[model samples]
Target: MTLDPQRLLRDLFDTAIAAAHPRQVLADQLPADRSGRAIVIGAGKAAAAMAQAIEEAWEGELSGLVVTRYGHGADCTRIEVVEAAHPVPDDAGERVARRVLELVSNLEESDRVIFLLSGGGSSLLALPAEGISLSDKQAINKALLRSGAHIGEMNCVRKHLSAIKGGRLAKACWPATVYTYAISDVPGDQATVIASGPTVADPTTSAQALEILARYGIEIPENVRAWLNDPRSETVKPGDPCLSRSHFQLIARPQQSLDAAAHRVRAAGLTPLILGDLEGEAREVAKVHAGIARQIALHGQPIEPPCVILSGGETTVTVRGNGRGGRNAEFLLGLTEALNGLPGVYALAGDTDGIDGSEDNAGALMTPDSLERAAACGVSAAERLADNDGYGFFAALDDLIVTGPTRTNVNDFRAILVLERHTDDH
Candidate 1:
């Protein structure tokens, strides 16, 4: 049987996504019956779907609100689904986040609040802290995206700047039992980093947020800086009474998704080497993958040929140019350049949620001849990479993978298929 590397790689991505779908993993994680009201609140790319999952599985009276990216809403009867901007907060998210805080406030001890947290939740639940405006928060978020800051660093700052994040939401729930079911996106699945840890105790400090901003050279507005410096803006810490009653569970994570993909690869009679949910700048991560692929092809050191290298985790791209593409595209572009059309090697990098950066495509694919084909089409891979135009480069080759919102996110899914090295001997 002829092996279609592209198909295999894509299949692995699908397996990874399917493993994290809310319907598949959430129902089992829900809490049992509570005497008081059951209120569900959440924000993220997967918020709406998770709310729907709870509505389907729990046969109790439940009502609440959840904010998801504009196009990623799922049908829920009791819980209200609010569409909002992501990767950056908007007024819509602010409005809904306020309502979420109000709903859980002054609740009784018997009341239960199920918070469906996921990636993008930090922006989705955008409630600026006192003295900070939405515009201020937006500006800082945009700067962080372009500043090449990692998710942890960005969230560390976001937690300090927000009113509802960094365990404040759980604090608002007060005496109510807060049950947080999160779909992990950040590396290591740190509960506090996922959506800024709306329901979990935040160990990150305001001083740390200030240091991250300084380290990234991100200029902060006067008021925002003052708020970060204020001791009152600190998040709920471990052993805090507000979060004492809250129980957090990571229902889905990047490593689990990678394992699912690896299972599929093994079923295909191919050895799978998981790179362990790598995290770094996109271009740097791509170079690392390329180095590994080259090693396997040239020396067969890590593993023999006819193997699939799998990795998962989020990677950030510092936009140097007004380019159109997400981090996945940037990674592929870098990988393509490094691979230089090495024979019998193909790869795919995509976000599990089906969107890469702010673009419509999930990600893109690269074959051994990607560079040669791009040149034929009058497209320069290196130039595109310089301009951070991965989407443009791949679009020109009709290689962009366009899967409209998968409604689930486990960060990035990357797979490189390395086949047997070919030798020319006639």
Candidate 2:
């Protein structure tokens, strides 16, 4: 088969995305026995897409509301799709969150609530706990994003501060059963971590959430601190009566997406080495991947050339610089700098959701001559890295991969393709 690095990498990403899409995973996960009337509610980048899938598969009277990030909306006759903010809370999210709680409330034991969840749901369903305000949630959310906290830690704090998350939604169903179908974007694929586990019982506590804030040196609001100290901020815990009727299922996950990408790469005639879902500081993780790629190129310890290294997981950025780049772009920039323009190394890192750190582009691509192209354009690789300007650096070389609103997110997708080494290639 002919080799086109850019096309192959992008195709692999698309294939992985297709594998986790609601259409691919939701139908099989539909309820086998409908013991009650169904009401659907969800919040996330993929909620609208999930709603569409539910409408297409289920044969019943379904009506509900869901919130999704703007531009990710899909037409659903039964499920009303509302656009909201993400990675940060907004008034729109705040209002829709209240409606979701009301919709699930007052249901009988014979009623069932179908909740669709995915990455970005945490921010999309932003309803502050008692004594807290939307602005307060927004402030804490911004701090969490900039504090370099991982998704789990961020959601821990969010669940404690939320009125609907951390199993509160399920609690509202009372004797009714709440069925939660989630697409996992976190490292461990824990049901409790995805979208802050709106319908799943949380084992984490308010005290732990406060501790995470302190660990990250994030400043907590006076009321938020007071609420955290009080028991009212506590999420629904395990063995609670509210959780007995909750049914959680992971229909899609990051590792599954990674495996799907690897399968496609192998089918295309290149050996694929899946590194599994990874997490950490983007640059630090890039350094590790850079070392592995270097080993394969210089010594071939792991495998010979013509192999693609793939991984999926959410990476963090401290946001020290005012650079316009997401974690994936930062990872590629860090990888590029660490590789130092090594021959036969090409890569692409992107969020599966088609948005990277609130940027328009999905992510960026890197080639052996990427640095050279930047140099010719008078963009210093080191300086760009210093400013956390990976997006700018790649944009200068016309290497950004832009795909608008894929509607489904399984977290970060990274590919490092190492071609066969030659003496002259060096």
Candidate 3:
């Protein structure tokens, strides 16, 4: 039976996404309702869907608000959902950030604040510190995205410059019992890093945030820099009374999603080798994956042919070119070049959130004939890549995967299927 690579890859992606859906993972993680009011407050790509799940599962009275990326919101009768900008903050996000603070502020001991945090929450909950303006925050955030800093490092800086991030939101909840349900998007799934750890105690200090900024050469406004230098601008640290009432739960993660895809690969009679959730610069990471694929095809070291390699985790792009693509596209473009259209190997790289960077497509796919197809279509793969135009390269061939807003994020999903070597070839 001839294997349908595209169908299989899409199925694997779908399976990974289904595994992390809030409805499937959240019901069991929710804390039992107490005597006080249950307030649901959150911000992320999946906040609305998570809020909807809470509304369906909770038996007691629950009311509050959550902010998600524009077009990522789900329908919820209660627990109002507000849509805002992602990857960058806007006035809507800032307004909702204030509202979230207000909802949890001055809460009683009996009150319960449930925070549904996922990837992209950091940007969605954009409340600059006292000395910093929103414009300053926006400028810094735009710089950070283009600066190629990893999520942890970017969020480290974000935590110190914000009023509500890095456990300050938990501090605002005060005596209320805070239950935080997180969908992990960062490497190692550190509870304190996802969505900038709004409800969890942050271990990253202001000094570290300053160091990261310096390391990345990201300049901040004068007031913002002064604020970071001040000790009072530090985020909530460990063992603080503000965090005493907080309970953090990791409901879903990248590894779990990868495992789901791995299972589907096995069911399809392909050896599933999960290359354990990689994290690095996107282009460099792609070259590494390409090297592995070549090794498998040549000597069959690591894992033999007819095997499928799967990986998940976020990758960064330095944004050197005026290209129209996100990290995933850049990764795939790098992979395509490294492979040189090697026969019997096909791959796909996509952001699980259904949007790769600011592009309309999730990511792109590459087949053994990808380069040939690009050439045939008068698209110079090498030149496009040099210009950091992965979207244009893939779009020319109509190979971009456009799944509009999966509503949940577990970082990037990547799959490479290596078929058996042909005896007639080489």
Per-candidate TM-scores read: 0.98, 0.98, 0.98
Per-residue lDDT tens digits for candidate 2, residues 387-425, read 989999999888998999988999999999998764532
The C-alpha lDDT values of all candidates are: 0.91, 0.90, 0.90
Evaluated at residue 93, the lDDT of candidate 3 is 94
| CA shift of 137, model 3, Å | 0.8
The alpha-carbon deviation from the true structure for residue 217 of candidate 3, after best TM-score superposition, in angstroms, is 1.7
lDDT of 1 by residue, 380-424 (tens): 988999999999999999999988999999999999999976553
Worst 10 contiguous positions by lDDT, candidate 2: 417-426
lDDT of 3: 0.90
Residue-level error in angstroms, candidate 3, position 40: 0.6
Candidate 1 — which residues are off by over 4 angstroms?
Answer: 34-37, 423-426
- lDDT of candidate 3 over 1-426, digit per residue (tens): 789998888889889999999999999887665434698998899899999999889888889999999999999998999999988899999999999898888889988888999999999999999978889989888998998888889899899999999889989999998899999988899988899998888888989988988998988777988999999888888989888899999999999999999999989998998988788888899999998888888778688889988998888888878879998999999999889988989999998889999999999889999999998889887898888899999998899999999989999999999997644323
Most accurate candidate by lDDT: 1
